[model samples]
Target: MTHFDVMRRLTGPLAALMVVALAGCSAGSREGDPIPAPSTSSTAPTPSTVPAVPPAPTVAPTATLPPPPLDPLTPRPSGANTPKVVNVTGTVTAGVESGCLLLEGYLLVNAPTSLVYEGVRVKATLEVRPDLVSTCQQGTPAMITSAQRL
Candidate 1:
């Protein structure tokens, strides 16, 4: 068969592929450059022929997050005359004091039953009882005197 016949068959399909590739890359072109139509005079695009499309202003991917919540470890001044009352607010996880705040269907420490589940928001009055709290958790320990779900 003649070489021209082979090239004619290949060019028809190859030109269609170029049209699709150019469409994806057209986003970076000038305001009024005419998209070249499929023709034998123009060479099929190579990687270099397609102007570099300085990738979609590569937005460094971000994660979904809430505004920073109240820190459970904020410090406050202590005076001998002042009562030790801690107003701690945080997500109450399944582990309270690292242990489930409930046992056998009973909520311990007067922790509201409705709020006993994990990840419940709580604002509670923690009475200072340093002796009963273990310092290993990197925070002070106190009894839950009262709590309100926020």
Candidate 2:
């Protein structure tokens, strides 16, 4: 127990096992070379190096509407004009030349003539024929008589 205390306990456990084996051989060397292994598998995710998140922005589709136009004195039924007189040219939004006879009210051509120029808004049995409502003149160009169309 004394060859100098067993050479100082074998040089302090051989200098702590040569400083833990030179700190695990200087953590895998550069000065001692050798450390490259690591790659065990698992990678796949590269649609072009992946990191472009921009494919969720594009929406513009919705349009559908058209249907409304039909009204020209609405009254057909009873042989609906069974080959009778039904001229109907259309234009005179509302005339009234009453001294002899003229009372017109057309607008049945392309239809929708904004309610045929007010003869007090028509209807009263279509102004009860004051000789065809006087002669109905607001613009001019009629030919009327029944000529239904509604």
Among these predicted structures, which one has the highest lDDT?
1
Q: For all the candidates, what are their Cα RMSDs to the real structure?
A: 17.7, 23.4
lDDT string, candidate 2, 62-141, tens digits: 87664332233554356532322334333233233432212243322222345343232333112122112223243322
What are the lDDT figures for the candidates, one per model? 0.56, 0.41
lDDT, candidate 2, equals: 0.41
Highest TM-score model number: 1
Cα lDDT for residue 119, model 1? 67
Question: Could you tell me the lDDT of residue 1 within candidate 1?
Answer: 89
TM-score of each: 0.31, 0.18
Lowest lDDT sum, 10 consecutive residues, model 2, at 124-133
Worst 10 residues of 1 by lDDT: 102-111
